[model samples]
Target chain A: MASSIRDELLKVLIEHQPHFLSGEEISRRVGCSRAAIWKHIEELRHEGYEIEAKPRNGYRLVYRPDRVAPEELAPHLQTKRFGRHIRYEYSTPSTQTLAHQWAREGAPEGAVVIAEEQVQGKGRMGRTWHSPPQTGVWMSLILRPPISLAEASQLTLLASVGVQQGIKRVTGLPIQIKWPNDLLIHGKKVCGILTELRGEQDQIHYMIIGIGINVNTTSEHWPEELKKIATSLAIESGGHLHRATLIAAILKELEEVYQEYLNSGFRVIKSKWEQAAGMLGKTITARTPQGLITGVAERLNESGALLIRTDQGVIPVYSADIDWKEI
Target chain B: MASSIRDELLKVLIEHQPHFLSGEEISRRVGCSRAAIWKHIEELRHEGYEIEAKPRNGYRLVYRPDRVAPEELAPHLQTKRFGRHIRYEYSTPSTQTLAHQWAREGAPEGAVVIAEEQVQGKGRMGRTWHSPPQTGVWMSLILRPPISLAEASQLTLLASVGVQQGIKRVTGLPIQIKWPNDLLIHGKKVCGILTELRGEQDQIHYMIIGIGINVNTTSEHWPEELKKIATSLAIESGGHLHRATLIAAILKELEEVYQEYLNSGFRVIKSKWEQAAGMLGKTITARTPQGLITGVAERLNESGALLIRTDQGVIPVYSADIDWKEI
Candidate 1:
């Protein structure tokens, strides 16, 4: 909450850039004390903002920070509802846990929970997601779509396309969706998404979509186990990318695709997802809960389960770890 | 929780029935003070238990209460897990709400939430269920089933059969399931079951099966709107029924069916449910969310959705209100 107030103060300082604004005047503009303005200025400087300060001439903003603070991201967020209720945290265990609680407490659709770092980040099947501080876009979106529980898997597929397109639009990165919800660049994972739903009988109450992206994280920052299998935007693109811009782009893409899905149905989103799916027409081995099964990746049905054609016939794989070593 | 402690004192008094037991003896057995034991005896008397107190001869139990207290129910509850961790409430808004929270907090499977009365009882599709004080079995069972989200509807059907057999065994009244989750006796609704699920993309975290039975409620106990459609075991059988015994019997039936459903599959439960389904091979008017659809109720599919053979095709109806007036 204090961070949000500081962000508002920073915004006021940025709006009065190139002209020196007095501490009292900036405090009046942002509705805080002069001491608060001074403190926020120091915090902004720590956040990489360059401010020109004089003894009596007040402060003048020289440069803005590249962080994904609320003041920086809210203006660029194009969605009508998505990302409107943003809960920004510098560090947290998991946004999915908070978002689930919010959904139970009747948080409106499109509320977002984003964090700079995660202490106990989780992936699907109880796996760990390495989230370094201030280097990735770790976020979760709370959705209350009026879809059946049977069709919830499609939303995971839909979110992959959203992230894929958002990255393509911002960084021109050639990202491919790995079957269900993992995004890959140059055959290594760059992002992962986990979708969870709460429902009654056949009706879905709400869903939480948690997306973790390795944005500006360096290879050396990765743990020894994750260094080989995971790649970041900085590693793949040969440069660092703006996290705020990428987050805004992804939320916009999700809102648009979601609106289309609600209006015209899942046919359009399914086609878009299939086009970006990487494992189609390839022979892969799926490590399912039952056992390992090798089959050709045929297509994704309407419910978003992968159709794998093996010697025993066509089997629908709802969930499995795919081994694409032959590729 | 206080009610449970008082119930423990009541159990101790009942165990020493016909013998005058001192307050000190009861307190030592229940691990409370003698004054607390006296207060619990007064509370139990207020709950309709008959007790006789003498100046120096101590106290003797004269009669047992007709209520479904924990002590009364636990002795009759024979299941291994179901009703083992019972949360008994004298009055609550709804057991379903409490059971949902308990499930979210990692409550074990088969943990039961039973209430004597509901101030704001809910039925299927946002309807109000009339739950009179101390006259009905209002309870919710928390189940952590190993099943897909698509198969959640089957648990509702399975619950219907449990309620059906339990009512049959206790009341000897011929009860039949009304297509999905409602149980009807003598062409009037006697019980209603609502099933809610929490899940991931394809995995079920837990499910809550809430059942409201008009066990001993009299005709005069119902509100004006429900008097015409609702009937109770007491009214139909011309005698009051024991709610604790009925509750234990239903939980035991649910445990057995659920165990079979998890092991041998839904085949046995489906057959049992079909045998007790009242609308089979009969044309029924269903008020579905999409619209009204009249058709002959065929067999239930593996997911427990009613497969109705309409004029167009065989459509699976997951949830709806069925009218059997034509039959």
Candidate 2:
């Protein structure tokens, strides 16, 4: 359904939250078929909305919009602090831009900036992410990890494990992680992570981790070219999912993983990321700024660098685009 | 005299700039002594103000505010691009803050942000720089150097050399450099360079070089404690100096040095910074976040890291605070 129609449907449902509304009345109000209204209610159920239904009386709201506020998720946030201070906007240019300003203004660590729609959602390498409204989850988290400039890259590896585990736990989907940190399902990308930081020679002042996940976005949200590579959770699972619940689950995992990293070092994250990426002994090409090197993915060294064994020797890749080579 | 009095005196001189005003009349208009008026005029002359003095007349203005505008200095900026798009403010919180916003908004490389006074100027390690009005060069330069994250520290070393040479050429002051770039004169700090960058894991998006110089400030500008460590050009040179001339000279040298870095690597900057800082073979203590290690300063390695020869072995220091040992 169109976002405006869906919003109007939601408004009509909310207006009659105190009493039940008949199916014909709701269908007329929403300008849709009764079967379409039933489908919309199912989608809303998938989105964490509890709509109680009866055979004759009609459907009544189990939770009102004011009671279960989706915009303010702090009370429902289960973690210690990750999403405790979250700001939700209906539309924005980019959440990363606002996160930078907020981080500089001394926002606490674990603060999140989320938006329903992004006109110019940013991607890696100065690219743009395709972000639609009321479907995917787009957010930027403020983090102040006690790490040096050289060790900042490890956080990217750690975040992928947290997010992958969270997705798997929430929807029971078989989410996999690629090299560095790209979440995938069935050989298609489902999420992107953009990590940016402002730092001196040795210390990182703060790091903003921008995450865009295709939670309930459908095929119509992506362009033709992106459809070949990008997939959403709803498309993969054939059912819609709740964005706030998924966000809360990811923050909980991320908080634990981050604390584990600070307490026990990257040892746990290293093992988890290595298992999740599953590129050991595979032939791949790393396209780095220095140049391209086709080699076998040997193993990750102590500092979380991908040490690739090439024809000449083992070259460690810091940051690059990994391409699979079929022989 | 106060800044208000100086501005009022300049206005009075400009009101009768077509002719000349008598000393008594000028002094009466400014509400100051004739001797004080003569001292202020001499100070103005030293500040690159072309004041024509006659026998019976007081003084005639040669450069009106609009005739020689100080804010839009594109004409005076000699480099191909550096400082070509300059924004001069009478007062601001911090030039670095503004430069970041402009850089993100697609400000071209070599764009400069200069201010007369900074109420909350920034310093390295989260300290505040003392920036006074009309007597210091407080500016931030936007740069898009083709470099990696590991090599970004070389820009700081390169900038110190440019600024040091510019000071020498403009005022003939014997300026020296400390490690990582701190400008000193007579064993006291005279200037500071805070190099901040925004980058990914391997590629740098842009770097902002914030330079603060105590150009012609008097001893009264510093607080009771800052007087022990901070000194200015006027205090050491026993004369006032022009702010814009010194700024242009620095920008010229910096542009050249930055170009050399992009063309010839860090070869020129390495030797120049080594000779300027004069830390080789000196017994010093490096206070690093890992721990404090007292060793002899050996040499700068290929990646621009300082190799310190300790009793145990040779350790490379990327960033640290160096304390000298007299023995």
Candidate 3:
């Protein structure tokens, strides 16, 4: 297959990076003709990879692109199939839009849409997200889960746990998962998870879990309004991170958590999340459209709804903007 | 606007149906040019209505198609904007798909999509619906309700109440909303509802509520296997029913109920539904993926989950396939 030939050529280039190989040498190494090597090189160039070709020398990897490519990142990935079918976009309005379209068009499970820049990325409540070019991980994954919408909220908690674990694994920075869907680092938000679904009353057709992490972005990249409440991996680690590796790790962890969630209930994920849950047993004020409700964060119920024990009663809050009290 | 022009032309045609009118006469009646009349007629024809025009005699109404056209149905509708903006299609894969797309594309709050037939119409549990041409109401409404996903099941009940009220208003047939999402007449299904949503943790962007009703279908038109379980309005009413009028009534009732629901809680709708509920205090068996639960259907909780008093306790059933013991 043409894909296999291209894969072989990519393997050779990756192995002999920073070195120039003649066309004849590459062809011989990949067990293909020099013309085939040239074709694959052209294709790689079209894919935003920088492969320099000289007259006598075959090809040299002058610059390696930081993209979520299976060939480049699969060796570092631990799980299967989650990040295997990735679609990289240089600029898109929204990764959630692309993922939903792909899911409707029968894209395989574990399909991902990653964009280097988003012109109109969104957060919860129709808020505009700050996704600068090549400074963060803005990705969405298509998940085909056999669950009801009532149980769908668990996916948000699961994704938060995975993102927390991934960030911990990459930069050794401790992170906490806020009650519903925020990844907090040093008491500031470092990532947000938006889970959306399309399904009937009893069956879910597909769900798109979108994640936006401020990786490699400096505090200066954030707007003045968000500087106090937002943090990034680069700012925490005092160095820039490899976006491709971090994304691969996040996808792998997400796949693992997703499988665990499907096999077992949210018990495992919930246990891990509870360990990193910083707001449990603390008094907090949640501002809902109905009104503000101040209560102690009791625990998460079986369906992933936040249980708040107030003076009135134990109210299962489906969604609210939380404001924690000073510890 | 061109749409207003088309509305005017539609008004003229409906007012003077079954009679041939010269282009000049139509232009004079609507104060528009003959060329504008011809263009509006073309647009209406493209919207699935049948209009025959002769060179000199004029345009004759060959078929007054039963479709949910904004202009044709708006005058008869009593709603406050819900279903006021209509998009009619002769054939579509599914109205819900189109409605979802429109909702994502920032369509208005009360936008609706109606189709004469759906090639890939789907019901709950991945079942293919029987939506033959001009035989059913394949309609989907875009609703932006201020509710969480956990509370969305109530919307299905609200829609069922509205549908039952509409059918009662038009045909005087007493119908019941089978728990969760079906409209039944005389122990057989006449309509099915599918509600889907797209949103994040703390906010709901939009929801598409799809309704499929067997309106003018005959026994022979249904699949042989479905004949025992499905019935149409014509079958029950002992006469032919106009699809456009029925759709308009449904939308009008839906708008009223939706407005009340947004203004208040589900108290009004739930009380109305409880009066027509056929399964209350009845022994029922629900087959869920977890296990089969046998209990007496006591009531519905505030969140719209079915409360079944089983031997263990009062089990709150969120999603299940139910079977009536007497049926």
Candidate 4:
């Protein structure tokens, strides 16, 4: 496959880092023709990777971009097929849109769509997501789960847990998950998960889980509009972050979590999410389309719907915009 | 809109009753050009209606084919927009598949996809539906309801009720809705409803409800395999039934039930469904992926999940294949 060749070429480039490797040497090392090596080098350059080639000295690794490439990131990722089938776009309207289209066209499960920037990214409640170029992880994962639409919400919770674990593993940052789908770092939003599904009656054709993580962004990276509430992993960790490594970790963790979810149901992931949840046992105001409901965030039910202990009763909040009061 | 022309033409044709008007006459009556009339008539022909045209006698009605078409049935339809926006296909793999595609491409609410035949029609549990040409109603409706996926099952129940009402209205035959999503006549399945949804997190994007009804099919018309279990409207009514009229009634009833469901919760519709449900208070065996659940079919919950009162407990069945026992 072209991807395998690309991966092999990337490995040789990383191994011979900071050195100029002659085209003949690269061909011999990678077991390919010199012309093939040249073609791959040109392709890498087109993918926004920086490589310098001299007439006699051959190719030099000038700079490796932070964008996620299967070749550049495959060595770090441990998942079997979750991130194996990926569509990397420099710019897209929304990863979710592309993922949805791919799923409808019979793209395999675990296929991913990642973008350097999203011109029309979306969050929950039809809100616009701010995805600056090369600043955040704007990706969507395609899943074909044999579950009812009611039970599909469990995937959102599973993704939240995976994201929390991935952030912790990659950057050693202490992150917490807000009940529902927000991932928070030091009490500010760092990531959000949006799960979409296509199904008929009992059969789920496919599902697209879109995740947006503010990885390498700073307060200045965000518009003045979102600086107050939004936070990035780089800002929270006080350093520059590797987007490729983080993406690989996230996909690896998601594969494991998704496997556990399918095998054992949501009980295991639900407990993990509850432990990482920041707003459990806290009073919150939720704005639903019907009306506003004030209640204590109790816990997630077996089907992954949020159970809110309200004055009226234990209302199962299918969807709502929750605002937690500072305690 | 072009749909308005199709609707007006349908009204005139239905009023004429087994008679055909020339293209010039229809164009003059509809205040459009003869070319426009020819175009609309061609559109109707594509939807599976058989129209006969001559040089001197002009156009004569050869046969009103058994199919679902806006032009052939729209005059009889009373819905506002449910059946107004229709995509009629001669053959599709499945209406649900096409409806999902249309929904993703920004198809309006109440839009419909009707096919003369489904090459690969499907039922619950991967069962193949028998959709013979012009002998059944294989249609899918696009609905943009403001409800969670958990509540989407309610649409199936509402659709069952609608189908039951529609059949009764047109054929004056008493039909019973089998607990989850089937319409039965004399304990034989005459219709099935499959409800699907597209959503992100808690917000639902669109819901596609596919309905298959055996219309104008006699015992000889059915395959030998389905002769004992499936009965058509014609077989039940002891005469050939007009497919377009029945489709119009179904769409009208579906529109009404959908509107009522949106305005109100599933409480009222659930009660009506319970009254017409054949398996209510009867011993039944339901086969689910988890295991077999045997109990007396008690009622339907708010979310339209079937409530079965077993000796062990009252279990809520999201989806299952049911078999009723003899009283």
Candidate 5:
């Protein structure tokens, strides 16, 4: 009930942002006393909502926190279904695991799970993601597409395209994709996408695409190993960006790309992925479970395999960790 | 407590199946009073176990019920892992659902869920399987194999081979496999296999393989629609067969075949599948999601796709319902 009152208060404030709603009117609108309203407003301020209060005119929403809390995100999200139903966590082991839980519980398609901090953030192949509190956009989205098992990999590529376009729109940085689904700026990793799925022999049941973006995350806190390979939007742009705005931008872009995929297929977005990839004709080494193979990364084929030219042959690599040499 | 006592009493009786333990010895072995032992014995008889009580002998195992219950299956199962833990439901919505539940709770690989009746038995592409009570073997098993997504379908083929070999060994009835994973006898389906999986972009997390075999199910109990297309072991053999024995036979064959698959790969089992399939050179029609395609059945490819020689050309089918013309 207290949460509902807060939500109501937030709704009223956001609806009339930059304009004052008198305290009595706000109380009546939220069905709370003026004293209660003041308390919640102070609580909101403590949660990083900047509100301005004058003598006669009661209160106006000045700024929103860089939080991905549903209220902070609802205003910036323009997508129909992507961020409309968000399960936000202040702290969690992994948003990917939460997304899977929600998906199993019949969460709607395109529902989102966002975390301010991931104590045990996940990366591809069981690597720690290192997501700090309110410093990165750590999220997972649920998707259910009627595609074959073979096409599941294509969805990962599609998500990479979304992240590339999203980071471009928000930070004006040209993000390059590292073959399967990692986003980089100036050859330093900024975002990683891990696509997990529930499927049958011939069909995919559901997919959870976990996207972790280092937005406004400072480099001083990075582990020594990550400092060499990873970079953040704040570090690259030399400014702290609004995390809520960044997530909204991503969800908007992702929903559009995902709808495009469902309407036609992955072919329309294939070229977009390739152009952002920039891995073609680059000297690369891929670490596979079988062993390591150094080759010239040729192309990402229609089937989502990274085709590489090696002394052995032009091999289509399915699953691997890629290391590309800088130009 | 009562269930454990029943298990203990069954163990004592089975150890002396042809013989008999005196009431005092039986009560002492079970650590229960003679009255309590007699009550459990009566309950077992009510559940379809046939026990003889002579003047001096406490109990003689006259006959064992055709049940896939844990105790009934314990001695028959010859596998090292498969069916090591049996979850028996006298009636359930679907064993597939229960298996998923247990799996989510960290049930070990090779744990089995069996149901006497499936109120909502699942079939491929959202069809109803129409499983009836205490008649057929409707079961699902959990598997965790380090296999690629493309190779998941091959597991179904391996399972089909297990079912074929099992049926052949148990009833001496030569069973034929439809291209992918259906078992047929005299042109009627005797079993259906559905393989579901949970995976990420790089690796498969787990796969649930649901196999429903029509053993000892009479025609009178079958829904009208299934009468023409489906047949049971009892209907085909003109006599009821032991459901537990058949389940054990399938588990044994499945464990051996599954182990071979894990050790070597599906290539070793490919020829075995082909030998049992008998689908090549037959005029066939495949009803796919796109549309129906008529052709001569060519062969099951290495990737587990059913290659059909259509008028357009030889095409590979991943998911379809088959309609084959009789030779």
Candidate 6:
């Protein structure tokens, strides 16, 4: 509640920047006492804001810090459901684990777990995901869809499209979805998605979609082995990006797409995914448990199984690791 | 370990009943001192076993309590997977809850959690399952099958056939499977099965199959509300039945059928299920979520969905509650 008051005070200060506003005016606007307004200004100054106060002049704002605090981002959210109840952390093991724990305890749908950094971030199939502090958008979204288990892969595809469109809208950079769960820019990976579900037989209980995006990470921040394979927005665009703005944009797109999918069906999402897919019609090799199958990537079936046309037949690949050397 | 030793001592006394076996001879056979044997016998007597002790005659077993202990059940398990590790509880809230928790913690396949009674036993669709003390087989079996999520209902059918055959072999009574997950004897439900799974997209982590069998529960043991719809083996067979023997028989049958299904697919299991089905070829009314689907229950498809031939078309029912007036 105190933080909300500070936000109200900050909003007032930003509106009257470069000019002095009286303490009496601020107290009246924020419904607080003049002494309370002075205390709030002191707290705001401690939070890396430059506020000048004189005997005659009341207060004037100069600068603000670059942070993704909730009080800073809550006012920017445009979605109806997603990120309404956000669990923000500075550092944690994995947001996916926390999302699963929260969903088990009957957390409301669209609850999000976001972290500035992950100490032990997990990717698909027990792989490690690189998540450094304050340079990426690392978060997990909780959903309790009424769809069956077979449609889970399609939901993952839908989320990938949402992330791709979000980054393109914010940065004006061309983004491409690489088949199932990755987003690429100029042939380098920028985002990875992992979708998990908990259910009983034919019905689903809840789903946790963990998304990790490389936002402002530079080449120096990447590990030696990953420097050639991974690239961030700042590295490709030659400019640093604000993390909170991009996060809010992505959440808005995701929530809109999710609601649309629930209302109608997956047709709209399927079309958007196919339009952004980088693997369609490409000659690729999918490494499955059976063996390597080199074929031309066809369209995704209704159940989101990738249909690969090989020499034998059109094989529906439910899960595999795809490689496109020409791309 | 002490309880196991007492079981062994009880076994020794039962094997040497009506004959005078001195304490020295019993100690030599069990690899324990005379004082230890005496202590074990005293403990066994406290566990509702009447043992006669004399100066020269070591001990004679008069009676044994009707309880399903691990020692009594483990020797009869003839399977490679099912019931290899048993977690026996004298009383618990529900074995299904415990089984799901253990599965989440990476419990091994074929782990069984059994309770003599349940305070909060649950049925499908949020119904109550009455489980009185030491009169029913309340257990949950953990299975990590290689099949997909859609085949879960078929696995439940396979288990029902296994239980039906096992009861027939033990008591020579006619048992019929009620379509998907119930076993009935004399038109009354004697067993209820609930199948739940934990999975992601196209992969499964583990499944818990909770089975509640009315083994030795008499008519007087059931609540008034349940007496009309529930029956037990003891009440039907006109004699007291041993729960350990029935449980061991069911496990062996289940393990064999499950292995066969994995190797040769669901054909054999489906045929067996159809042979024992009570609703097949009968006009039944199914209370589905959509509405009441009244039709002739034709047969089970390969995925275990029941095909009901209605006037409109043959609709495949994944889950529903059925009502049949006569077989």
Candidate closest to the true structure, highest lDDT: 5
lDDT, residue A201, candidate 2:
54
lDDT of 3 by residue, B77-172 (tens): 777787767888889999988998899789888889998899999788777888999888999999888887766777888988888888889999
Best by DockQ: 4
Could you give candidate 2's per-residue lDDT for residues B101-202 as a string of tens digits?
A: 899898889988989899999988778999988888899999987655556677878899999998988888778887777888887789999988897655
Give candidate 3 regions above 4 Å deviation. Answer: A1-67, A325-327, B1-68, B90-93, B290-294, B307-316, B325-327
Query: Which one wins by DockQ: 1 or 4?
Result: 4
Cα lDDT tens digits, model 5, A176-290, are 8997888888889999999999877667778999999998888787999999999999999999999888889988999999999978877888888888886888999998766
Per-prediction TM-score, please? 0.82, 0.72, 0.81, 0.84, 0.83, 0.84
A309, model 6: CA deviation in Å? 4.4
lDDT of each: 0.83, 0.80, 0.83, 0.83, 0.86, 0.82
Model 1 lDDT per residue over A1-327, tens place: 234667677667766778888877888877878887788788778878899988798889988766776777865677899888888888899988889888989989999998989999988866788888989999999998875555567788888888899988988888888877899887789999988888765567889999999999998888788887899998988997889889999999999998888888778998998888888999999877667989899988756778899999998777688888533
Where does candidate 6 chain A have its weakest 10-residue lDDT segment?
A145-154
> So what's the TM-score on candidate 4?
0.84
Interface root-mean-square deviation for each candidate? Answer: 2.7, 3.2, 1.9, 2.0, 2.1, 3.6
How far is B11's C-alpha from truth in model 4 (Å)? 4.0
DockQ of each: 0.31, 0.24, 0.43, 0.47, 0.39, 0.32
lDDT of 5 by residue, B101-211 (tens): 888788888989998899999987677898988889999999887765646677878988998999999898768999678899988999999888787777777778899
Docking class of 1: acceptable
List runs of model 5 lying over 4 Å from the truth.
A1-47, A52-62, A278-284, A293-296, A300-303, A307-317, B1-62, B269-271, B278-283, B300-303, B308-316
Clashes of each: 0, 0, 3, 1, 0, 0
Report lDDT (Cα) of residue A305, candidate 1. 75
Q: What is the lDDT of residue A242 in candidate 3?
A: 81
TM-score of chain B of each: 0.87, 0.79, 0.87, 0.87, 0.91, 0.92
Candidate 1 regions with alpha-carbon error over 4 angstroms? A1-47, A50-63, B1-47, B50-63, B284-289, B294-296, B299-304
lDDT of 2: 0.80
